[model samples]
Target: MKKFNFLGFRFLFRVERENRDDVQVYSDTYQLKDRMVYFLVFLMIISLSSQLGNIFQRNKYIDKDIIKENIYAPRDVKYKDVLKREAIIKDIVEESEKKYIYLPEIGKKYSRGLNEFYDEILQIKEKKIKNFDYDFFEENYKLKIAPEIVDGVLDLSKREINSQRKDLMEILDKVYSHGIREGETFITTMAGKDFKDKELSNIEFKVLDIFTFPNYVYDRERTKFEIKKRVDGIEDQYTTVKAGELVLKKGELLDKEKIQVLNALGIYSFAETVLRFSVTGIYLITVSVIAYNIVTTKFKKELSNKNIYGATFLVFALLFFIFRFFGKDYLYLIPFETGFFLLQILVNSAYAFYFGIIALIYITPMINYDMVYFVITLLTILFATRFLGSVKTRVQFINLGIQLAIVKLIIYFSITFLTFGVSETVLLDSTKIILAGIFSGVLTLAIVPYLERSFNILSSFKLLELGDLSNPLLRDLSVKTPGTFYHSMMVAAVSEAAAEAIGADPIFTRVASYYHDIGKMKRPKFYVENQEGGENPHDKISPFLSALVILAHTKDGFEMAKKYKVPREIRDIMLEHHGTTFLAYFYNKAKSLDENVREDDFRYSGPKPKTKESAIIMLADSIEAAVRSIEHKTYNNIEEMIRKIIFNKLEDGQLKDADLTFKDIETIIKVFTKTIIGIHHVRIKYPGQEKESEENKTDEN
Candidate 1:
């Protein structure tokens, strides 16, 4: 019996696996369904329900006049706009043109310019008005104010006399006018009778100029915008079907209007729900099974069952509902990249891109957008992801987002240009789409670090961090055991070359190689690398004891690596650098001393190299130590030594776990030979030197 929680419910299950003999294999823990599986089911159920809402609801909207013919309403429905039209209010909206409302400052500037030019005339006029300067006015212009003449001066009524004086004024009326220009053409347009005040004589009124510079003004750019906004926008234009209204007859042909009313009523029947949900469930299960097959078969090491399901949940959660809802309507604005970005970050680039294609293809029938857009987006994502092969940095990832945005913008513009031309509305939507692409990339940067921490996955950025040689364990090895450090460096160089030749991750291989032999550092003097002053510690101890001391490094290195918080991949390399091969020299020495000595007791405890990097490190470690030990070096001799090391590892089953091919091994051997030759090349002796050396040797004999 097994207990499991699924979708917030606990259940007891009886599950059994059988062998060839039909005996039950215990798999209670293995068979417990993970929550991520439940999440996928939950996600798909909701997405399917959302889709059914559309599928059951009718939307075949086509307007037709039935005034002449006998066409009845379809089953009760509301009117809806099925067509995705650019709001024709575009015609009403004044083309995003700006009109500035000239502030009070504009009028002030106009008035100030007029005042600056006619300042003396205005000032004299002001003084003349205050002092009643009839003498100066008469001398300058041969004009005089008709202030009721001298007769009214004796019986002066202040209000009447002042009105008469102002009515005869020429300067005040000529200098400033509200919204009137300075020329006669504009003055004639204004009402001339208004300037003819009854308080003054006809001569005073005639002498006065009718026009003054217009002061009230506004900016056309600003005012035009205000007018356009007030003029047009999206209006409430939908038609609704009242309850119990006869939408259409059953036998009537389904046109656009009848379909819309049925859609609005959410015309769901029990039979339709069952059929649609059943179809959706089958679809969900099919794709899930294929994804599972790929995950188990191809990405077992890189991803766990939980990781695969979790990533699927993320993709569907980002995609399914959005497509089921908005994708049916505004499919052009659908975020194709949200799930794609998360997939590439949570999973690998290749997995993310391929899986994204499968998901997009599956949903193409449901969305309203053109298949061309969907295909273009899928292909673009594949290119962007594949282009970023293995090496990735923050900046490169950001630039990738920019590239996606640029590509999306170009594609969208091309489509729009072909279909509708570059209108204001199309350009506006294009900006939104291109921004979504860019946001996909930027959001990746924000989301990845969290997933990396949660899953403890090794991203390219994390790999780069581990590739640095200044880590604590490596620094200690370099200082306390310099010879071992040199050996490790040589191993790293060779492993990196071999890795690159074989299409493995060279950075990871080189990094793992640097610390593959860290266990040996624990017993530095026992091995050849760290012995000081020509003294050997292993010589003083029994060969059996020496083997035990040497074998303890793998165990010790694992503990130290755990303490230093070394990444799991590097730690794995350390543990598997040497397989369970017998320490031969010590085992043979022990056997010669005591014939009862056992080989098993002298073997190194190992799980063997489980990945390509570890396997390459294993080979490089053995070959570097062997070639470094040789005092006499030649290309032919070095080649034989390397071939022996490789064949022995192959025969002993140490290479069984890694994914290296025969072709890969052969390529590695060639690269290793080239690298070793470069490292250990010897200068050829000249003929005279060789002869002289031989003659000296003969004389000494």
Candidate 2:
């Protein structure tokens, strides 16, 4: 140790190996290497996390050119060509061109033609019958109008009929003799009457050629329906794609049929591979950076510890793994909030909040980018930090756990009800959310003990456990040294009160006080508190030797604390209980024995009180012993004694490193005075004056 004097203040520069528990140490060489390792590990996780989003992504659409060039039927895949058959049938029906073959306009035109032909034929027949019958029969002999003619001829009919109609439709192919009407037939009713046989003269068989051909042919609509029926009857048309055949060759065009076949085979295209890789890379990089920044900066303290950072990494890995495997379907089973709460207990609330956000970033994308998980986890973390600040006892943890769980359940329920509404799925999902909330709360409680024990991390819960009376060191102190135990109890009572009055950790002070004087258990009778039968061991010892024995207790207590595995905070308090102050009684005794005795020889070897609780413990230890030896136990006397003890420690600079203010000291003095007076107050009973009181009462009567 080297002393550096600054102005009038002397500063001791201590160079020693200290316990690296809460503090961050700086080393020059490998610090950059450590940071790089963290960054590289984070990058690896980010790269792998990309594949989690790939789990549910749809395959990309292939370019027609690429599909034609690269794809093949690696294995036989068969499926139905659901649209090909129906499509072929439709094409066949549509390909057959419709034929309109409507009849020509014949209702009025053919009726007029026939009537004119009939008049002309009748005139010719009249001329032949009346005047030229001799010449017409003699020259031609083709006017074959005979009685009951069967092989009739239109040889005598005029030329130049409707030539196009006759040529195209063969309208004049109808057989008739010379002159005819609707009532006459070519054979029977031509030269005679019906069956009565009475028209042999008035209708001389030459005028039956002209007849009306109706243009009111088959109804056009009826004809169309008939033609459609005929076409529909020919429906055997088909197009087939045989199984295990080249439905779509690698270079073939991607028509509808080809596309159908490819889809049926369940083949993914090259475009999908590129797309999956791209998307995975994007999501991984983005989320990894965000997660890294948040956790590193927010949880820097906890991460300073290798075990803590390892645990945090484990949390991230577990979350990502669950998202990759189970996805958001079973989000209830994932202990997301538990990890956040654990970090809060292990570190700080600010760090835990950002750590929770990091969890959100990592898991949200991996699990389908679901806001439900993010929102629920955020709410649970907020509630945990707000309500479960520092859990001391297991019962306190349970109470807070239940409260946090209930509040988380309400938040989850409200979110689900508002988003999904009331339904069967909603009910089931809400139940899962509630279960997850409670499960995470219970998990946080269960894992805390293992974390504390395995890492030797001091927490409020550990302090509460140390405060238990059943610890081996405290138990041994009670059984091995009763007088010292009682004195320690008085110190602990006032120390706890004073620590609480000034907003320090009271339970920690009490536990530290219980074990502070554990060195006295080694030599019980040497100290005045443990002396029995009024014997004093220091009577036979020199002042220098007695001071050596008394000063050795601090060292002994430090060793016992190590053997019992006490926390650094408790061990520090045990060592610093006396501070580096000169024991005045022993120093005066040594001075009287030798004129050249130096005060440094009687001073206790100490690091001084370095914390508020330690400083209060030092004062309480001194004040408790001083009050016990006082002749008068009056309130004024006790207050005076306690104030002097505190003022003396302050004047001696023992409380230099403590974070106590003037206000805190005043509060400590008031609390210590109240506690001491309560313990050693005087009674009003008078044993000697009782007889005088009875005689005075009788005289008054």
Local lDDT at 139 for model 1: 58
Q: Which lDDT values do the candidates have, in the order given?
A: 0.65, 0.65
lDDT, residue 348, model 1:
64
- Those runs of model 1 whose alpha carbons end farther than 4 Å from true positions after fitting are 1-43, 52-347, 362-373, 423-425, 521-525, 532-534, 659-661, 681-701
Angstrom error at residue 608, model 1: 2.4
Least accurate 10 contiguous residues by lDDT in model 1: 22-31
TM-scores across all candidates?
0.60, 0.58
Report residue 215 deviation for candidate 1 (angstroms): 74
Model 2 lDDT per residue over 602-621, tens place:
88888899889999999999
C-alpha RMSD values across all candidates: 21.6, 19.8
